[model samples]
Target chain A: MSDSKAIFLKDAAVNAADGDQRAFIRKALGGYYVNRDLQKARYRDWERARDAASLAKWSAVNDLAAVLEQFVANFERNGGVVHWARDAAEARDIILKIAADNQAKAIVKSKCMTSEEIHLNDALEKAGYGVVESDLGEFIQQLRGEAPYHFVFPCMHVKREAISELFTKHLGTAPTDSPEELTMIARRHLRQLYVDADIGITGANFLVAETGQISITENEGNARLTAALPRIHVALSGIEKVVRHLDDLSVLLPMLATAGAGQPMTCYNTLYSGPRKEGECDGPEQFHLVLLDNSRTRLLADPEQRDALHCIRCGACLNVCPIFKNIGGLAYGTTYQGPIGSVITPHLRGLKQWNHLSGASSLCGACTDACPVRIDLHHHLLHNRRNAAKEAPTLFDRVFHHGFNFVIKRPWLFAAGGRIFRATLPLLQKLPLPYMGAWMKTRDLPEAPARSFRDQWKNPDA
Target chain B: MPDARSDIFARIREALKVKAPRPHLKGEPVAGKTSAAAKPWLPDGGESAEASLAILAEQLAKLKAMLIRVPDHASAAKAVAELAAAKNWKKVAYHGHPLLRPVAAALPCEAWEADASFEKQRLEGCDAGLTTCESIVAQLGAILVSSASSGGRALSILPHAHVVVAEAAQVVPDLGSALALAKARHGDQMPSMLSFITGPSRTGDIERILVLGAHGPKELYLVLVG
Candidate 1:
C-alpha cells in the first residue's frame, strides 16, 4: 500500500473502532437484511396486483428509458430548459452559470449526491454566494466542513457530544447532548436559510422520460421546499437514471427501497415536471435538469462494466464491504466510496492515478452478493486489477506478477518452487516482514500444510 | 455548454439504439421480446364516502395534524377565528378553492393567491395557512398536494401551521390511485411539485433525534368537512 493510503486506513480503523464502528455497521447490515426480505414480499404483491387499471398505471417500469426521454421532451416543450452534463465539472459549471445568470446571493440545497460530487456548495460559495445544505445530515456535515459519510445518513460518524460542541461553539449555546433538542436548534437555524435562499439545487432519484418528470424520494421534506421555494430549481443526475416509462419504475422502485434504506419506499416520492402552472400559487419560475455523464459513457461502452451504470447509489455494496467496515469511506480518497467506489473510481478518474485501490480488496465476493440488481463486483475488481497491471504497473509489482506468472504457467517449476518455498519458511519467518505483516497484525494467517499433495502421493509407499 | 448539448444528443441516440424498432417484433413492439407476462397495475380511484372519511382521519393522525369535525363552513371559520385570536397570529393565507372561501373571510387577516413572488412573505409572515387537498391516500395516511388554483405548493409548505381541508369524497386506497388521479387531472405533464405529505415537516439531521418542523410547517391540521 502507498504510504498515504496506509496512513488513512490506519487512522480510519482507529476511528471506526473508537466510535463503535462494528456495532453500528452490524446494525445497518441487520436493518438492510430484514428490510430487504420484507420489501421483496411487498414487491411480489405489487407485481401480483391484478386490477386492470392498476396494471396499466404501473406498466411505466417496462418502458422506463422511453418514459424518461418523453419526460425530457415534455419538460423542454413546457419552457423548462434542460441541460446535460457529461461529468461533475460540467455539472458544476452549468449550475454556477445558472446561479450567476440569476445573480443569486444564496443557495439552499437538499440531499443531492451529484451536488456533493461536484462540490456545488463550495463552488457557489467561492463565487461569493452563500450556500446552505438544507437536509439535516447535510446541514450537520456542512457545519463540520466534512464530506458526507453515508449515502442516506451523512453525519453518521458524528456523536451527540460532538454535535453539542459544534452547536455550542457555532450557535452560542450551553453544551447539551440531547439529539431532539439539537434537532430543534438546527431547525430554527435552517428555517431562515430556507426562506432566504435565492436558488435551490437537488438530485433526481429517477427521471420519467414519458412524463418529463424528476422523481425525488426522501423521508425529510426539505427537498420539497428546496425545489419550490427558490426562484430557480436545478436537478443534476446521471444519464443512466432515465427510465423509458414511469411504470418501469414500479419494478425499480421496490429494488431501490430494498437496496437503499430497506424500506418499501421513503415517506416522500415526489415528481416535479416544469415550472409552476399559470394559475399556481407558489413554485419556481425556472427549472433546470443537468443530466451528467461523468465517465459513465465509457462505462456504458463496455458491456461487462456497463451494469455499473445501473447503480442507484443505494450504497448496498459499501454497507457490505469488509474493507469499508474497517477503514470507512474516507480511506478510499474519492467522492464515491466503499466497494462500488473502489471499482468505479479508477475507471472514472483513470487507472493510472488510482490503480492501487483495485489491489485493496481481498476478493471476498460480499459486494456482488449484496447488490440488489446483482452487480458482480468482485469479478469487476479482479478485472480492474488485471487492467491496472497491464496499464499502470509499478516496477516491483510488474516483476512480481511476471515472475509469479512464469512459475505458475510451468507446473514442474511451480512444484519445485513450492518445495523451495517450504524449505525457506524458517528463513522467511526469521527475516523482518513488511506491509503484509502489518495486515497480519490485525488478522490471523494460516500455517502452511506439512507437504504438497503431489509430493505426498509420490512417497505413498514409503 | 458543449457537454450539455452534445452529451444529451449522444445519450438520446444511445437510448434510441436500445429502443430501435425491428422487423422481428412480431407486433410485440421491440426485437421480438414477448409481451410482458402480466399487464401493469394502475390504481383504482374507488372509495365509499365512509371509507374516504376514515382514511382522512387516519392520515390526519399519522401527520399529527389536528382533526376537528366541524358542522359547516361557518363553524370551521369560527374555529379559525378562534385560533388566530388565541395565538395572536399576524398574517394568514388561504387557497382560492370554493371550500376555503368562508374560512378565509372569517379570518381577521388578509388572504393572497399562490404567487411565487409572495412565497417569502407568506413563508415568513404567515402564522397559519390553509389549502384544499387534491386527494388523500388511506394506506399511509398521506395527503396528495398539487398546484391547483386554490392548492399552491406553498399553502402546505411555508406556514408555521398548515391546515388542509379535506372532503370525505377525496380519499383513495394508496399512492397508485392518487398518482393516477394526478396524471388524469394534469394530463401527461407533471406539475412543478406534487408533495405527498403524510405528516408535519420533520427531520433527524442533527444526530438522528426526530425534530418536528424543520423548514416547513411545524404543525399540520386537517379539517374534515362533510
Candidate 2:
C-alpha cells in the first residue's frame, strides 16, 4: 500500500469508531435532510430537474474545446485577462507573478476549494505574502491551523466551546458559546480585511461560455465583497467549471441551493462578466482568470468517466454516503472527500496509489440518487477497481482466480471438492487456517449440506 | 512551444471521439433530441401579477426577508423613514436613482448616495444600504441587483443591513424572466456585477446552526412600491 493509503486506513479505523463524532455529524445533517426535502417538494418534478441540470452541464463537457475557446474570447473582450495553467506549479507561479506585478500589499480570499486543492495558500504564504480567509467557516479553520473539516461546512464538526476558546485565543475576544456570537466575532474581525485588502482572490462556481461570465454562489456574501473592494481580482478555477450558457443558471442555481444547503437560493449568486466596466460604480480594476487543468484532462481522457466533470460540487453525495458519515471527511485524505472523491481521486492522482478509495464504498448508490448532475458515482468506483486490477494484479489475485477457474472448469473435480468439504466441515471449523485468521475472527463456517446439489438434482425421488 | 490552452483543448478533442450514454431518465428523448428551451421544474409562480406578489411575500417571509408594500413612491419614502426611526439607523447609503433619490432625501437618518465611483471606507461605516433592483422574482424571493441599478457592488453588501427600494412593476414570475430582462436591457454589454440577493446573508457553518449574518447584511428588507 502507498503511504497515503496507509494513513487513510489508519484514520478511517480511528474516525469510524469515534461514535461521538459520528453522532454529531448525523445530527448536524438531520436538519439538512428536513430542509432539502422541504425545498425539493417545491420542485414540480425533482427528478426531471436533475435530468435538465445533468444535460445543461453535459452540453458543456461534450464540446469542451470549442466552448472553452468561445468563453476565453468573450471573457477577453469583456476586459478580463485569461491565463492557462497546465498544472498546479504553473498555476501558483502565474498567480504569484500577477501579485508581484500589481505590487499587492494585502490579500483577502473567500472560500475556494480549488485553491485548497492546489495548495495555493501555502505557496502564497511561503513567498512572504499575507492572505486572509474572509468566509466565516474558512476563517475559523484558518485560525485553527487546519484544512476544512468539510468543504461546504468547513468547520461543522467543531463544538461551540472550542470555537469560543479559539476566538478568545486568536482574536482576543471574550469567550462565548453562542453560534451567532461566534459568527459575529468573525464578521467583525474580517470586515476590515475586505476594505483594506489590495488584492482579492475568489473561485468560480461556474464559468459561462456564451456570456463569458463566472458565477459564484455563497451564503455569507464574502465572495461579493472580495470581488467588490480589491483593485485587482484574481480567480482560480478548474477547467471543468465552464458551462454552455447563462440561462443554464436558471435551472442550476436553485438546484445547487436546494441540494447543497437546502435553500431556494444562497444569499448571493453573483455573475461577473469582467472587471469594473468603464462607467460602473465600484469593482476590481483588473480581473484575472487562471484556468487550471492539473490532470483533470486525465479523467476527461477516459470517456466512461467523463461525466464526473458534470459535478457541481454541491457536496450532497458526501452527506448521504455511509462511509463518509462514519469515517468523516478527513479520513479520505484527499482534497475532495466522499463517494465522488472515491470515484475520481484515482483518476485525478493515480489509480495504483489512490485505488483504495474505490474499495471503501458500500455501493448502496445513495450518492447516485443524491447527485444533481447524475455522475453514476457508484459504478465509477467499480470501474476504478477493474482498472486498478488490470494495471497491477497481485500474487494473491492471480492465485484466487486461478484456483477458482481450475476447480470450476471440471464438474467432477468440483463435486469431489464439495464432498470433501461436507465430510470435514467440523474439523475445518476448528482449524486455525493460514491466511484466513482475520476473515474467521468474528465469523463462523456455515453448516455443510449432507448431499451435493448435483447429486440431489439427479436423484429427485430419493 | 505549444500553449497550455491548445494542449488542453487538444486532449479534450481526442477524448470526445467516444460518446457516453445519456442519462437514464425514462421517456426522456435521446441525446441531441431534447428541446432547445429546457423547462425548469421549480416551484409554481402564479400566472397573474397579484398572485405572483402573494407568492413572493410567502417565499420572502420563509427566507427571513421582510417585504413592505406601499401605494406610491411617497409612501415608499415614508416607509423607509419609519424603518429608519424604528431601527434607529445612524446613517444609510443608497444609489442615485429617481425612484430612490426622493426616498434617500426623506430618510430620518443621514443618507449618502453613491452615484459615481466612491471610497469603500465611507460606505463601510453606514448602518444600512438601500438600492434599487432590476427586478424581483416571485417564484423564489430573489432580488436581481446589477451594478448599474444598485449603486455598484459594495453598497448592497458592506453595510450591516440592506434595504432595497423596488417598484411592483419590477416583479417577475420566475428566474428565467429575470435573466431575459437583463439580456434584453444590456445585450452584449452585460453589467460587470449582477447578483441575486435571496435573503439576509447567512451561514450554517458553526455546528450547522443558522446565523443571520456571517459577512454581510444581518438584516434585509424589500420596500415594494406600486
Candidate 3:
C-alpha cells in the first residue's frame, strides 16, 4: 500500500480539524444505533437477567487479575495444564507441543483471537495436521485460506454472492446465494470433521477464575462440539480475560451481547474448566489453557496504556469507530484492525513499526463511549502517537514538534509562520506538495480565502 | 467443584496482584433497594408458561424451523415418520426415547439408537437425525439436550438434519427459569450432555449473512407435543 493509503488515517487527520470527523461519526452512529436496537429486541429474553447478573459479572472484573491466577492454579490442580507465554512465539510453541505430543492428525478450532495472534493454524497445518475453523465466519475465511478481517465477524467484509461462489468452488456445486443452501453445504461438510478431529482449539471470551471454566459464547453449536467432541481441547486467551467468579458471567455476558452483536447473550455459552468428570459422555479428555501475554504484560506495565487490557474483544469500539467504517479492517495490516487495533498494535508490534496506526483515528470519542467497560480509546490513540514520537520520531516530526512548541511559546513567530504558510500555499502547490497534500487525493481541499476564519469571526460579517 | 472453583480464584487473585479494579461494584441491586419491577430478563412484563410457548413457537416458525404440534405421543411419533418420508431422509439416527419408538419402527430407513452404531450409521450417510429434547425454554426459544440415555451427544450434533420432540409443558419462560427448572429437577445430578439450542445452528460469520446449521444441525425440526 502507498504510505498515504497505508497511513490513511494520518492523512485524514491532517485535514479533519473541521466537521469532517462529525460526518464520519454520523454515518457510523447510524450503523451502531440500528444494530443496538435490533440486538436488544432479538435477545430480549436473555436481557431479563441483564441487570442483576451483569452487575455481579462486573464485580468480578473489579477483581479480575486475582481471579485469573486462582483459575490457573485450579486448572493445574485438576490435571488440566496451564502454560503462560509472554509472546506469540512462546504461545505457538506451547500449542504446537501439545498437538504434536497428542499425535493430532486433524484439528478443529473455535474462534480465538489469541490463536490468531500466534498464527496457530499455519503452524499446525505446516506440521501436517488438518485444521478446520468451526465458527461459520472463521470457516469461510479458512476455506478461502485467509485471515479474519474483524475480531468477531471475520468475514463481515465478504458478500453473500462471494460466499456462494466460495462454496461452489470448494464443493464443486452450482453457485447459489441462499443462506440456507450455504449453511447446508457447510453443515454437510463440517459434521464429518467434528467426529474425526483429534484436537479442538478455542478462545475463551472470559476465563472464570472462580469456576476454572473457560467461557465461550457463540450462536452456532460449533464451539461446544469443537471442545466436546475432540479428545484434547486447548483454550487460548490473553491474561486480561479472567474474572472473579461465575456470578460475574451475568454482567459480562450482557455487556458482550450489547457490545458484540447487540444481543442480550449469544445462544451458546459453553463453559469447560478441565477434562470432563467421570460418567460424562461427551467433552475432551484433556484440556489445556495457554495464557498469552503477547504485549499485554508490557501494556499492563505502562500506566498510561494499561486500560487497553480491559478490552473484552467485543469489537464494540470498531463497530462504532468512524475511521474504521470507511477503511475497513484490512488497512490496519495486522490480525486486529480497527480503533482497538490501532492502539494495541503499536504497543504489541512496536510503535516504530506501526506509527501510522497511531495517527489512524478521527479522534472521535465514539469508541470510548461505546466501550462496555468504557475504555478511553481516543485518548489511547493520542497516547500511541506520543509513544511513536518518543520511540521513532522522524527528522521532519522532530523539527515540526520543535517548531510547534516554539511557535505556541512565541506568539510573534507563530502568527508570522501561519501567515507565511497561508500565503505560500500557492507557491507550495506549484512545487508538488508531499505528505500533507496526500490527504487531498481522497478528499477535496478548500482554498484559503483572503480573510482568515479567526479574523472573520472577530468581524462577524467579514 | 464449588470449593475447588473458589480456592482457585482466591489463589489467582493473590498471584496477579488482583486488587479491586473498580471503585464500586456495578451490578444487581442490594436486594430490596431496587424495584421488583426491574426484571430485565423477563418479557415486556411477565409471560405465562403457555404464552411463552406460543411466542417461542412463533419465533421458531419465523426462522423456517418446522414446529409440529402433535396431539399425543403416538401422533408425535407418527409425525416424525411422516416428516422423514416427506423429506426423503433415508439413513436415520434415533435417540432411544420412548416417544420416538413408533417413528423409528414405522420408518423404512435403517435406524440405530444413539450409540456407536448410530455414529457409524451417521458417518455412512444420514438424511436426518431424530432426538427428543430433555427440556425447552420459551423465552429464548432454546431446546436442552442431554446425552445420558436416548440421544448420543454426537447424534444431536454430528448430523446434517436434526428433528427434536419437546413436551409443551417443558417450555419455560427464559434461561434463568430454565436453569431453575434444571436445578430443581436434577438436584445436583446434572445430565452428562445438556445443550440449549435456540435457533437452528446459526452463524453470521460471513459478511453477517446469518447461515443456519454451519457445523451442527443445518435444519432443526421441533415437534411440540401437547
TM-score of each: 0.81, 0.96, 0.80
Residue A3's lDDT within candidate 2 is: 88
Top-scoring candidate (TM-score): 2
For A138-191, candidate 3 gives per-residue lDDT tens digits of: 888888888787787787766679889888888887788777777677766877
- After superposing candidate 1 on the true structure, give the runs of residues whose Cα lies further than 4 Å from its correct spot: A1-69, A251-258, A359-366, A394-405, A408-411, A435-437, A443-448, A454-462, B1-4, B11-92, B102-119, B167-169, B218-226
Ranking by TM-score: 2, 1, 3
Candidate 2, residues A1-462, lDDT tens digits: the string is 798899998898899879999999999999999999999999888888888889888888878888899899999999999999989999999999999998897899999999998899999999888999999888888999988877788888888999999999988999998999899889988999999998899999999888899999999999999999999999999989998777788888999998988898899999998999977889999999999998888888788999999999999999899999999888888888899889878887888889999988999999999998888999999999888878998776789878989999999899889989899998988888867844575688998888888989999777
Query: Model 1 chain A, poorest ten-residue lDDT window?
Result: A50-59
Which candidate comes out best when scored by lDDT?
Answer: 2
For each candidate in the order shown, give its overall lDDT on alpha carbons. Answer: 0.68, 0.89, 0.68
True lDDT of residue B1, candidate 1: 39
DockQ of each: 0.30, 0.65, 0.26
TM-score of chain A of each: 0.88, 0.95, 0.86
lDDT score at residue A111, model 3, on the 0-100 scale: 83
Give the local distance difference test score of model 1. Answer: 0.68
* Better by TM-score, candidate 2 or 1: 2
Worst 10 residues of 3 chain A by lDDT: A46-55
